[model samples]
Target: VLRNLAHNQRNHTSLIQAGAVEPLVAIMRNSWDAAPRINAAVAVACLVGHEEGNPRLQLDETLVDEILDVLDAACQGTMRHGSFWTVWKLCQGLASLTVNDKNKELITEKGGVNILNEVLHDSHYNNEAAHRYALSAIWNLAFNAASRLVILKTPGLVDSIRDIVHKSESIRTKEAAKGALWTLGLEQDVKSLSETMAQDAGWY
Candidate 1:
């Protein structure tokens, strides 16, 4: 219900105005039910994605940690067969959280870069949406110095990303790969990176 409501930016603003962020955070913080927690997480992710000043001031590291735990569970296939959408949702959540400076550091501190990198590497054969989400998450994390260092430190991650950039035939995957590499400072200097999306390919 809440996730659908937050699908539109204007509706998300209205929901935020109606004090939705607090309860959504509470749900993610307290609910043991995966469905409720993921739903609330999507909603809060929308709020934090708002184009305003420091929207993440309303959030904290605990939220990113919680999202990562669920993401790891999804990657581990512990969530009702571990659907691709679930993994994508969690990765998307982490990507959004990286917009916050503190959350970016926390993501590396919490081992999120490796988690996303693992997804990127392992999903290369599957060509799932989660594959792209993992790439996007890695791209986002590369914006932070600490997180970028951790991503660079992750074995095979750089090779995987570089490989995707030159080998991926899918435009979506190739562009996302380029974005990740560009942010990681491996690609030749370029203008702003697009938040590329594709249902196929993986590298980080």
Candidate 2:
């Protein structure tokens, strides 16, 4: 099953080489069943990045954009039969894709930041997983300067993330929320919180 494969990092290449990507995309785009759609998204997330420095998923620019588009559409509920779990899985895939630098830039250009921010405002799915992975996706996007500034400007987004940090019971979600806040709090400046502490300690 895709979920089992997702748990094992070693199977990533084997699955992709077997042409699992296209089918997975198809499921994410058109699966009438929410379970298949959600599983497909998680499988795609597992194939996302590796130590090779080239994304297993970002090999094609158009494919990357298409995935982002699916995610955006799914968030908006235009994609058929999408459930809260499906949206969460889609966010998980988006977060994983942001592991690649090029994907980060592409996602920003495709309005993925605004899309993720809207998840916080949408009342349709107050699902915890969706909120967590949305924060995680934004956390990854915050690594880029442009994305960070855009995130700051998005209405109520920063506050919504902070709310999650204080209220979420999931430690993973809280960590991601904190990570996004920390990254955005830099104000386009260099020095991280740890870096600032080290500098003050005269560690150089």
Best by lDDT: 2
- Candidate 2 local Cα displacement, residue 101, angstroms: 0.8
Candidate 1: tens digits of C-alpha lDDT, residues 10-75: 786689888888888788768876667666867777666644255533344665566677777767
> What digit string (tens of lDDT, one per residue) describes model 2 on residues 33-91?
65565566567766754432644444245545555556666766775434333466667
RMSD of each: 6.5, 6.9
Model 2 clash pairs are: none
TM-score of each: 0.71, 0.66
Error of 1 at 73 (Å): 1.4
Candidate 2: regions farther than 4 A off: 1-42, 48-52, 59-61, 80-85, 123-126, 186-204
**Residue ranges of candidate 1 with Cα displaced over 4 Å:** 4-38, 47-52, 56-58, 80-85, 124-128, 188-204
| CA lDDT, candidate 2, residue 70 | 64
lDDT of each: 0.68, 0.70
